[model samples]
Target: MIDWNSIAKKFKEADAILIGASNGLSITEGLHLFADNAAFERLFGDFKRKYGLGCILQGMMAGWPSEEEKWAFWTRLIHHYCGQYQPTPVMNDLKAIVGEKDYFVVTSNGEGHFELCGFDPTKIYEIEGNWFTMQCARPCHDTLYSSLEVAEKLSAAEQGGHVPTELVPRCPKCGGPMDIHMGAGQRMIPDTAAQARFQNFLKTYHGKKLVVLELGIGWHNQLIKAPMMRLVASEPNATYVTINLGEIYIADNIKEKSFGLDGRLDELLPALREACEA
Candidate 1:
């Protein structure tokens, strides 16, 4: 594990710090992204019996062959993760730290925690897109519409261990498919505004004395993490600080300038916040 005391000191001295959050942190705070719960198990019991699928989350992602089915699964996921879930103290602490500094966020977490915690949308780069909105599955245009009402309906219908077919979402215009902009594949459309903000952030801050604070970013999706880490490494005075449970390692190029803390963000962020404050 990296010495957080030293890491905190480095963070305090940095000009800009880009904090990143991932699904692991969300999971640590009692939100299951890909895991199954009792409710989901019951709802998917029939599907499970038919396909030998144990977890609803995994089964839905794996079993769905079409965009329409994928959207249905994501619609359900977004409804629960955004509306019903509570933000962790760690997330709150991290938000506080960023608020105190010249900071930006580049996160893969679809829960929209940073924004919910009052981070400026311009300063926050949501690479995985938000859970509160849906886009055309085909993504003919980079348009996103609010999914809050739909999410609420889906959540309500998901009671009594059943997912009502009527609650299943479809494209409003085309009557086709609508999915969360989660970057599942090439078809995944990033919100154009968010994409512009991310590019602006990169262009403005690249190769600077920045601190890249990554929390619970795993290897499952290297699309965002790898490039961001590389950007930090390219800078002469940039440092990469990663706090993750079990796995905590960085490239050798940034190793001397990096701190790898092998632990949960729920435990680490508050400590780091105190240390930074001190």
Candidate 2:
């Protein structure tokens, strides 16, 4: 019962767009972190058999006996999910919706899809970091090392669920283990430059006709969702459009200016693109 035409009109009239996304958006892009479905089984069946880990997230958090084994798992994950990722239809639809509008993307997803989809890298902030980079486990410094080459090499060298001991990535400074630059407690190096860029984006669009387009953000996500809602509440001209799988929510204060489209993103995004063109 959502009005796609009305939502498209809002998108068209907006002076700037602010996008907020989370794990649900990643799911729409065929990267389900929590599900142990056919895709997960196909990609990670060996890990499940070896470690009894249920899903991608479990494999990410599971303790391994050695750094070799750990890197073996990480390399496979990075190789498949990051190195081999191609932009999906959902991403293309989103691009059509945004069109030529000035936009900034703030996402908790670490999968690096926004960059892969041809979005402006400087305008996208990955709050949980991304799969394409790694940092020292002890975080000896703030430097983030590119893991693309490392992942490829390790993935090729991996044998019997373990990479060669010499092939494991070690910090150049501390010689400690390296971990993917993600949400790994205090050890994770923060993306201060990206954070600054996002803050600047907010400042630039403060009182403009901003469209806060939230996609697949769950209720528990205070990191991205809460701040977006707050922006909508403060900016009188801001229009809030949220699309999710179920139980779409609009803040009571901004309900009058909000549109909630609840459905699968794969279906909704293409329909929305059609509506926008119409």
Candidate 3:
């Protein structure tokens, strides 16, 4: 059983809150990357029909006949998801719970949720690439560039489910196709700034009053999960809290230092928020 008040108090009094969020948390925020449901159809029905793609993940991987069609699909996706940054109740409640305590987020999701949900960008480390940025396929330069303007234009100019060929974004340095800076390909440039932030996070809170909150992370993506677990185990003052819908568990040895809350994020977040209020 989860001691809600205790978890709340941990957050309330901790010197820092370190968050490791993955696909589950993204789903809770209504950005399901791998889901093919009613909302998928409602949001991306056209792409599904035109490209025979079922989910965002499939549509992204599907090879299009033309760059125009491909970019059309991509622009709409980025615009619908990342272009408009809005705050959700979960984010609001998380902010409320943190209440100005120092926090750092290391997210595998590239949906730009942290920034949109009011989390400071400087404190976030998006290990995966973001939809709002682009890089040269050949990586002519070592830098990543913002693609928000191009995506917005393509989204606005889409007609009959495709963008104009002229609207297709290309590398400024080299006339090559631009790709989202996600972790899909080896060519993807890792965010050095985010790396620095993570190092700083570790340096600042290595052995103090820390709470490592792991939400919706699975074994497949263990970059953040593995490190966070090790941190809690290594630090005597640290506590680890895990909230996973499926396969939720904590090591028996660390049970005293950890709290496991098994349920959907949508269900668990509100419950925990209420607990904090109580």
Candidate 1 local lDDT, 87-156, one digit each (tens): 6687788876665767877777767766776778778777767676777778666678777677777665
**Steric clash count of candidate 1:** 0
Local error of candidate 2 at residue 143 (angstroms): 0.6
Q: Output candidate 3 Cα RMSD.
A: 1.8
Instruction: Give TM per candidate.
Output: 0.82, 0.97, 0.93
Q: How close to the true structure is residue 227 of candidate 2, measured as C-alpha lDDT? A: 87
Q: What is the Cα root-mean-square deviation between model 1 and the actual structure? A: 3.4
Q: Sort all candidates by TM-score, best to worst.
A: 2, 3, 1
Each prediction's number of clashing residue pairs: 0, 0, 1
* Tens digit of per-residue lDDT, candidate 2, span 1-278: 86888888988888999999998889988889999999888887888898898999887877778889788888888889888888899999999989999999999888788998999999999998888899988877889999878999888888888899988889999999988887356678889999999999889988889999999998667999888898999998999988889868888999999988889989998998898888
TM-score of 1: 0.82
**Whose lDDT is greatest here?**
2
- Model 2: residues with Cα > 4 Å off, grouped in runs: none
lDDT of 2: 0.88
* lDDT of the structure predicted as candidate 1: 0.70
Error of 3 at 264 (Å): 2.5
Question: 1 or 2, which is superior by TM-score?
Answer: 2
Q: Report each candidate's C-alpha RMSD, comma-separated, in the order given.
A: 3.4, 1.2, 1.8
lDDT of each: 0.70, 0.88, 0.82
